[model samples]
Target chain A: MTVDHEPVSTADGGEPRFSTWTGKARGWALRRLPPDKLLPEGQPSYVSSWIYVFGMGAVAALVYIIGSGIVLALNGPTWFHVSSLGRFINSTHLWSVELFFMFMVIHLWGKFWMAAWRGGRVLTWITGMLAFVVSIVTAFTGYLLQTNFDSQWIAFQAKDALNAVGIGAWFNVADLGQILMWHITLLPLAVAVVVALHVVLVRMHGVVPPLEAAASDAQLSSATPNPATESEHRK
Target chain B: MLGIQQTDAGMPDPGIYFQWGDFLIQFGNLVVIATMVVLFILALVIPFPGRRSRK
Candidate 1:
């Protein structure tokens, strides 16, 4: 018996098919470049407050940390142990991380207190918080990758505690090489993915208003009675 | 997290290993841990009146 087979089209075919990165898609990506900067033209009128600075400040610190980290990586971990320039860069990177965590913690608190998660924004808040938690783990691993005396001591200490807690098999903090790869690759990628999702959610939901106004509006509408008032009351 | 053994083999002697760096590291660690504790307490204790209003 003879079997018939369908022919597959190739480049030689008369008509050309465009790739996913075609003009329209490329334009869409470009228009959405720097996801966090989507509101460059204007933020919502309700986005006023010094509290908002913490989020931007955290991003700035992350930028500095990544840039300085790249320089340190180029120098190699051992360079910081022997070279003055490398040491300075390492110190700067360390301070940048400290500031990054500090700002992120404050930003998280501010968001929580403001109840910024309201109005269909819970996902953004949760994603950003998860990103923060992942960044902390990444930082911890990076510290282990330093391969200095401090790194060695911290690794042994942390390994002991983690082993006691029964998670030692999954994460070997003493594996400097593996930890370095995770710090430079996996962690950063995870952080980037979560941050992208966070920005998308924020844009879709828009910035939440201050609690006072939102509450007053809720009370005012709730005090009145009607289907429209009920909807407004539910706000 | 890694291998766990009760033996103290390869562990540096705490008595002979004291240094300014170790002191600084310990002090810094304590400070960070303390700050986090305080912040966590404040987060829970402080009345989030604003959030109630917003809702």
Candidate 2:
């Protein structure tokens, strides 16, 4: 019943614990993302613009969607199909998804107009797009799991198209077990991973500056071209 | 029975108090399709009337 109070020492005058992958990860993270840069209290002044806020809104909506989804999942599938309370929770999840999609589309369009890939933000941009694609796939599988007339019609009508393309063999929406696993587990997990990476990249590289600000700043910097300033703002 | 069973969803419900309450819900499919079509067209031709949008 006694717990050991002493730390384990390595045999060869060095600790294996400090020299492991965990230590390397800690060092790498600290070097790449210090706490102040990772989670800043004050953003750059240019982020004050209205267009920059939609990304935050999308993240917020995603949080709500996940929270509601967990609640609904805990209640099981039949409750949401039949009970009033479950129906309300289901509706909340649905509306949250609608908001998530709306925010994502607006954010994507705004970033596109901003030419947000300027400098080294290409991976940030791509991950966001990939998250959207994953979310759409998740949503489609969700529709298949609806257990309603809508789901029925979608499977009935779309099965031919899918089979013709050979996708139906692998991703059979008509198969409840397959689609449900995808809806509840695989797709959502993929989306979460991609979204996490997207946010980390955003935090790693600070929010992109406005075109005018970047242009003026570029002009002020030394004549040597900074990769960040290589953008030609469409005038 | 397993392949194409129909559910009671989308069937008309008795709405003595709210006759037209389901109108929007009933027609939402068409609205969604139309909206997608419109949005796609807009995306293709948007930032329009110039070489590139100044914004």
Query: Which candidate number has the best lDDT?
Result: 2
Candidate 1 TM-score, C-alpha based: 0.63
Q: What is the lDDT of residue A217 in candidate 1?
A: 59
Runs in model 1 with CA error above 4 Å? A1-37, A164-167, A215-235, B1-55
| Candidate 2: residue B9 lDDT (0-100) | 44
Candidate 2: where is the Cα deviation over 4 Å? A1-20, A215-235, B1-55
lDDT by residue (tens digit), candidate 1, A160-235: 9889999887788988777888898889889878877886766655666667765555432322223455455556
Q: Kindly report, for each predicted structure in the order presented, the TM-score of its chain A compared with the true chain A.
A: 0.72, 0.82
User: Model 1, DockQ value?
Assistant: 0.06
| Model 2 chain A: ten consecutive residues of lowest lDDT | A218-227
lDDT of 2 by residue, A128-174 (tens): 99999999988888877888767877877778989999888898888
Backbone atom clashes (below 3 Å) for every candidate:
1, 0
DockQ of each: 0.06, 0.05
lDDT of 2: 0.71
Top DockQ model: 1
lDDT of 2 by residue, B11-50 (tens): 4331222123334232444454556456545544444332
